[model samples]
Target: MPGFVGAVQIMNIGSSGVFHIGDVFQLTPISTAKTFAGAGSFNTGETLTIRNHQSATNTFDNDGIDQGNNFNL
Candidate 1:
């Protein structure tokens, strides 16, 4: 799911379930979570990504962003 930076934005998440980067943001399994601080369970091998707007270039920084790997479940 190749998406342009800053081109996409999350409007909302439904009540059926919570949203995740890979689930709602249309990101790949390896992508890291860029926003939304929370403690939620995820499956193993699952990954997520988020944008880091605080950077100078406003680009997606792999180090600045948060990542979830090696899930407990």
Candidate 2:
């Protein structure tokens, strides 16, 4: 879809924009703490991975934080 100003199409109007970080990640630490890319390790209770927007594993199937886990621990 494109909206034109008479003859010129506008650039990305409602896009989510480029990802701030370019790294595939999964939910680590099934219990205590976790990191984005599983760079750190914790007790593994449950885990799921989502790359860009969607995931086949459907991390939401269970009750746990599946996104944005980068605390200064």
Candidate 3:
């Protein structure tokens, strides 16, 4: 069987807000930083789904990344 991933909700409180996916979440103020702090663990060969808050559509699918590969920082 295949594993599964779900949608993520991110809110922008600042004017220069931009969303990103990373191995872990970061508290830095850098705009080019890759943070995955909110990510969870998952198994291999998993089917992951990523969606945007603005639209009710899924943006990414079957990312093929292991749960331990990266954090949602």
Candidate 4:
């Protein structure tokens, strides 16, 4: 479909980030982040720790609602 987008400023974008100005059929995003931290430096034998070691399990079902609906401006 016909579309127009003006000026846009984005600071940061993640691993599964998406930016759309006009129309979109389906936007299914599955994102995960993990971080480990420690107090002292690694040279001092400070062990890195992870508070949460869990994983991500995601599922999606896009039934093709807006599959094709193209139009003019």
- The RMSD of every model to the true structure, in order and in angstroms, is 18.6, 17.1, 21.1, 13.2
Q: lDDT of all the models against the reference?
A: 0.46, 0.40, 0.47, 0.56
The C-alpha TM-scores of every prediction are 0.18, 0.18, 0.18, 0.34
Candidate 3, residues 29-70, lDDT tens digits: the string is: 434333333233232466867544453434354775534524
As a TM-score, model 2 comes out at 0.18
Tens-place lDDT per residue, model 1, 30-67, is 33344433233232465655445453434455685354
**lDDT of candidate 4 over 40-63, digit per residue (tens):** 323344566645456444334356
Clashing residue pairs, candidate 4? Answer: none
Please write out the lDDT profile of model 2 over residues 15-72, one tens digit for every residue. Answer: 3233322343543342333424332223454674534554233223355545553672
Q: How many backbone clashes does candidate 3 have?
A: 14
Give the best candidate by TM-score: 4
**TM-score of predicted model 1?**
0.18
Candidate 3, poorest ten consecutive residues by summed lDDT: 34-43
Off by over 4 Å in 2: 1-12, 18-60, 69-73
Cα displacement (Å) at residue 69, model 3: 34
- When summed lDDT is taken over every stretch of 10 residues in candidate 4, the lowest stretch is 64-73
What is the Å distance of residue 16 in model 2 from its true position? 1.4
Question: Candidate 3 local accuracy as lDDT?
Answer: 0.47
